[model samples]
Target: MLNQTPLWKYIMVLMVVAVCTLYASPNLYGEDYAVQISAAKDSTVDLNLVDRVNAQLEKAGIETKAVALENEQILIRLNDDSSQRLAREALESALGRDYIVAMNLAPDTPEWLDNLGGTPMKLGLDLRGGVHFLMEVDMQSVMTKSLKDMEGDFKTSLREERIRYRRVSIVNDVVQIQFRDQETLEKAEFFLKNRNADITIVEQGELTLVASMSETKLAEIRDYAVKQNITIMRNRVNQLGVAEPLIQRQGADRIVVQLPGIQDTARAKEILNATATLEFRMVDLDHDVRDAVNGRVPPGSELINDQQGVPQLLKQDIMLEGSHIIDANSGVDEYGMPKVSISLDSAGGSKMSLGTKGNIGKPMATVFIEYQATNEKNADGKIIFVPEREVVSVATIRAQLGSRFEITGLDSPKEARDLALLLRAGALIAPITIVEERTVGPSLGQENIDLGMQAIIWGFVLVLAFMLVYYKAFGVVANVALTANLVMIVGVMSMIPGATLTLPGMAGIVLTVGMAVDANVLIFERIREELRDSRSPQQAIHHGYDSAFSTILDANITTFIAALILFAVGTGPIKGFSITLMIGIVTSMFTAIILTRTIVNGVWGGKRLEKLWI
Candidate 1:
């Protein structure tokens, strides 16, 4: 009597449960491993870099159960404690030597039941408890790049015109000039205008003309950088594989990324605070800085520091910049000097060829190696560097002439390797640092789960009590179907690959509980109307379900459409809400219509029964 639902309806419920069980089962079957990374204050994690790290973990004989990159943090699940430690060691080595921030192991997690990718459902940050971070884009880096690009253009223009100018540089967002009187400045401005149309010349005085990059150009550059940052951020996230990571632009120069389920605070810091911009400059050994300070360096070149820390008066002309260096890697020289192997594009290759060819046998130090360092400064704000002996030579560059070059200046054994890893990975151009950090332990997650379960239980009780009070026996039947419907929804979700359960998703489920019984309520009400209109109970039952079917279809169709649209447009929790709601609707329709109809037919078959109260 209790199992009066139609055979088809029974089959549907059983099939759903079976499929869910299958999906919720883990594939590995042996052990669960996990690692955590937390972004610290004043640091921003690179989601892409984190992925490379996880890959390294896998290479070290450990497999990842889950990798969740959270807001200002990262968390990973592995096979077991030993595996986790191995993974953590690999991660720490990578982060400490390659990236530019401080990270720690945080605290050890107690033995969790090996549920890596299991169906008990891991809660996201908002649902469970974890660190949340809001990161701002590096506008300073953007501005610096813009200035450098403009300066590069200025140099090119001067060289093309063959006009000898005293000095041309960017200072405070405006191009300044110290030319041979006002005539040379005017001529240089005119030449630059042809090369760059967006510069506006405003006369500061007779001897100087303040040239500003056009407002339109500036706006265009800003917009482009913001969009570029979004793509870069997205790539990083995809690499990290943070379940349902949220990355979007907050404003023109700020981005907001939320990584749920992260628990290590310090490790998160290392991933975010790196500015992986690599550059190559030849040492200007043709002149001495003493001459410049004493006003006798040279007419065409400026004095600059070389790889040996000695000042050389080299030509001011940039043979090849970092942008031309397509790739860089860390490697060892024949004599064991740490060096970064650099690769150049066609243009860079030609320039490097010409520059290195003429200066062969003569001294040429690689200039501007600041981009290679991990941490730029010490605690006291002084710059940090690996000693001179560790620095690589131009011969290091020559070995990989056409291919990618390795910067062997990496002092620590692992440093060169990690640097090579980052460069080959096409690391981020802009510097991003986490301005904040925190961690959420699994215990806190368990507490949230308890509370969420309590809420769900309370909600069901209230819904059941109300239904029974109002509709009596009909309400009881509908309530049973409702309960079955909820089970089906959960079961179905567990079966879908990307379907995750979150707090908002729980809200969707609760809302669906109310919706699941609508068809039953409508059918029962129709049956009562038919009975009152002089129809027998048997006739009432048949007509009620038959008539309600059309209405049920129309109502569910609209709600289903809305859920689909929500799924299409929404992100993160919103998408989770839509998915759960959609699945519930489908399950509710099956239970309420076919199950209720079958039960009613079984109860009052071929008889005009009275007294419907239970």
Candidate 2:
């Protein structure tokens, strides 16, 4: 009974190993070379596209393992790398310029295992090969936009307070108020300074007041712009069907994005760089569209073309900004036509309600505004955004629409879905330009994977050989636990969402193989000490494990703390390394202590041995 483990503990141990082994087995099956097809914004993806792809592959004499349509994309698996390249070329030629055809590696996970929520660990950009972008937020544009909004608010507030102002305009990132007299200027300055804590008010002259954001406020604006752009970029990247994307703030006004397993850089750039928003404005029913088109636009109306290229007149004042939209979904209308249902926030609802109160019968136009980069670059080596506005929908106000509404007259379901996706991705607070971009090819990624695997395998083999020769029979037990430790690490990584293994992460795994046997070494040495002191084998094993527990706990806890610190403070590859190190520490502790002890106890627990093999 000295070293005996409880029956329940044995069952628990076996159950854990079984589950881990089952999950970890998927990685052994390897991956397949595949080509993926994604539809453009106006195009649609269906089973027909899959059939066409198969037909093209067949015509090209390219053998394909399988073809499946999933998540609005067609994935065609090929037999080898040659077939993959040939299929990609053939499919791209067949699909023309309407679809994005890219090479990818698809996991060959069995259907049953996939259904059971079993998946291989996700590889990072460095391991799987993808595109990396370093984007810089336009802080100047951010400040300008903020000042413009503040200028509008200031003008509205002064008019409501009966404080007459000659003009309220934004100049050089500051809101300037030109009042007719000093009394009105003082009143406006006092009101604005008290109302907005983030801005500082300065009396410029006898009848002028200047309001600018404080330094702290400016810093906050820059930080918030970068963070918000990162979030929106992440949402947009989801449409690319990337498995694990890394989007994070790099500096004060820059973000680092890594898209793993994405070979279509053009499509990725289109999705990430595109900025779209919707504006709700009253249509100018009194103004003639022919006159507006001929450059005789009304005083407060602007001429814009709809999606169909027809000119229309609309009020310049925006009743609701796209930022007020909370959610959007694509669905069929009552007449079975494609439509997009949109929900607004509280402020947006109030604005819509008030704006539509007196204009029930008037038509409201939903103006779609997109800022696209031009082919020309500015002096600062940045692309300039050209503003493109079009009226996507013009609907009559059936009643006072508030909070929720639907935009009908969509050309197709694909258009509706795309509009919904754009709305759901949210509007960028400020435009961003990619300052640097790098693409990691699949061959290099495979090379990294091979090297990483070699490091892990060699390290494991060395450790296994050493333990087997030194401790003999007891070393075999340690090796078993060590194998279990590795399995559990991979299993846990696969189970956790957003946990990606990078090159440095593989190094962490290799290091874990070396460090995993430390506890076993301590236990075996302690048992030798106990046995030399004339204790029985069972007593030596029990006392050795009991005494070694404290040392193992302290050592592993300290290392784990370091790993946590690294994870908290590090970025990108450092973070990946820290994750694996932390996970390895945990799994190693469990396997080396509890698991190895269980084996030792069950095998040689109640025996009286004359000699010990350890």
Candidate 3:
């Protein structure tokens, strides 16, 4: 009974193996090349749309394995990539912008397993082939905008508070209010300190109060720009029907976006960099547009060109910004004119209500702003981008607009839908320039998968052969555990939501194949040493396993710690490697010690033996 494993222990090990094997089974089913079609905001998606897609695909002479509408999206599964591309192109043209036609790799997981929350491990860009983008957030733009907004708010607040100031301007990213005297400056500084908790009174002179955003506030703004960009990119990716995208903050001012299975780099860029924002400002009826456009611009109004390049004067004060918009939908009005209905959050509603109440009969313009990156670099070696601002629409303020409003000057339904998509997806707080772009085709991804799989297979087979030839019966137990070790590794990887199977991750698995048997080697050698000292086979087996546990635990603990550090500090591929290695170390320890010991117990435990083979 020296080496007997309890019934409960056997049950636990069997249960673990059974579950891991079950979860690992889905990866064998592979994937289906498919096109996913989702409706735009206020657009309808139904069986009729599925029929339309099918007809279009058929018209293009592309055969689809199945065309179905599920979860408010139409999915067309094709036999191969050729048909997939053909079907996507045909459907996109037919469906138009009302539907988001995106290329996807729909998993061929069975209903039962899928319903049980079993999914194959997500593949990374290197393994699945897609686009990788390194985007840099414009932190300067963020701080500048923050300062401008604060200046606007301060000027308005001081006026409302009956505090007079000669000038309020932003100098060196600090808002300076120049008062008539020191008494008024002190009054303003005291009022500001009480009003806003995020501003610091840097220096107060005789007639000027210099205030800037506190370090914490500036940090929060920087974080907001980066994190908000990540969030919006995720929304755009979801809208584009991308599956398992990796969008994360890289550093203080950078982001890493990896879209797996996305072949269209242009589409990827469009989705990530589409920071179209809207600004509502009153058309300056008091200013002369001709004079402003020619040589003498007005004091508080700017000369802007409409979408048709017609000159117009507009107030510089923004009544509302698109950042406050919560939702937008494109629909036809009663007259059948295309329009976009907008919904604003509570703050925006209040601001719009206040800003438009006095301008009832005046016209307000919707200025569309799009940032474009240029090859020209700034003095700081950063790329410079131009914001092409155009007055898209001018509408009369019929009444005081609040949370709900409509803009009806859209030329077509497509334009209205495009505007709605931009609004609904949320605007990036600041513009992001693409510092780097890389595309990995599906063919290359498949090549990586093949090569990585070959590495793992070969390494695993060699380890299996070595154990079998050297330790015989004990080797047989380890080989079985090793197989289960692999199964459990895949299973655990699949179970973890964030785990991605990259090419480097496969290398981690291969490294683990050899390391998985080290504990077995220690135990078998220990048994051989004990047997040479004239111990019985059962005694050798018992002492061998019991004595090796501490060494195995110590060795594996150190490796796991190193892997943890790597995961903590690494990014992208390094993270993939570290995570997989960490998971492997854990699973290997279980398979090598617990699983192999249970097998050895069942096979040869408590039996009388004159000699030991291990």
TM-score, every prediction: 0.58, 0.88, 0.77
Q: Candidate 3: which stretches are off by over 4 Å?
A: 159-183, 193-220, 250-252, 276-426
Name the 10 consecutive residues with the lowest summed lDDT in model 1: 101-110
For candidate 1, the per-residue lDDT at 26 reads 35
Candidate 3: deviation at residue 334, Å? 28
Instruction: Tell me the lDDT of model 3 at 123.
Output: 93
Superposed Cα deviation of residue 435, candidate 2 (Å): 2.1
Sequence-dependent TM-score of model 3: 0.77
Worst-scoring 10-residue span by lDDT in model 2: 152-161
Candidate 3 lDDT (Cα, 0 to 1): 0.85
Q: Give all candidates' CA lDDT scores.
A: 0.61, 0.85, 0.85
True-structure Cα RMSD, model 1: 10.0
In candidate 3, position 575 carries an lDDT of 94
Model 3: per-residue lDDT, tens digit, 1-614? 68888899999999999999989989999889988888753377887877777777777898777887887788888899888888778887887777778788888899899998888889999999988889999888888888887887787678767899999998887888898877877788889899888888744776888888888999998997787788777887875666678899987999998899876577567657766567888999986888887878888888888867998799998888777888999999999999889999997897787778778988998888877778798888887878878886788888889999987767888778767776776767888888898888888999999999999998889999999999988888999999999999999999998899898999999988778888889989999988988888999989999999999999999999999999999888999999999999999999999999999989899898887666
Which digits, one per residue and each the tens of the lDDT, describe model 1 over residues 1-614? 22235677657656755555444443223223355564422234668867776678767877765665654457666655576656666777766643322222222222342233344343466664555555555555567677776666565556556777766678788876566777777787687667567778665755665677788987877776666556556545433335555566666766666665544444443343333443344554555667676878777666554334555555555555544655666657898876666676786675566555545444343433322234676564433433221112333233324334444444554545544544444434355545445555657766766676787788889988888999898888888788777767766775566677777788888888888766778888898898888876667777888899899999999999999999998877788789889988888898898766666656655454665553
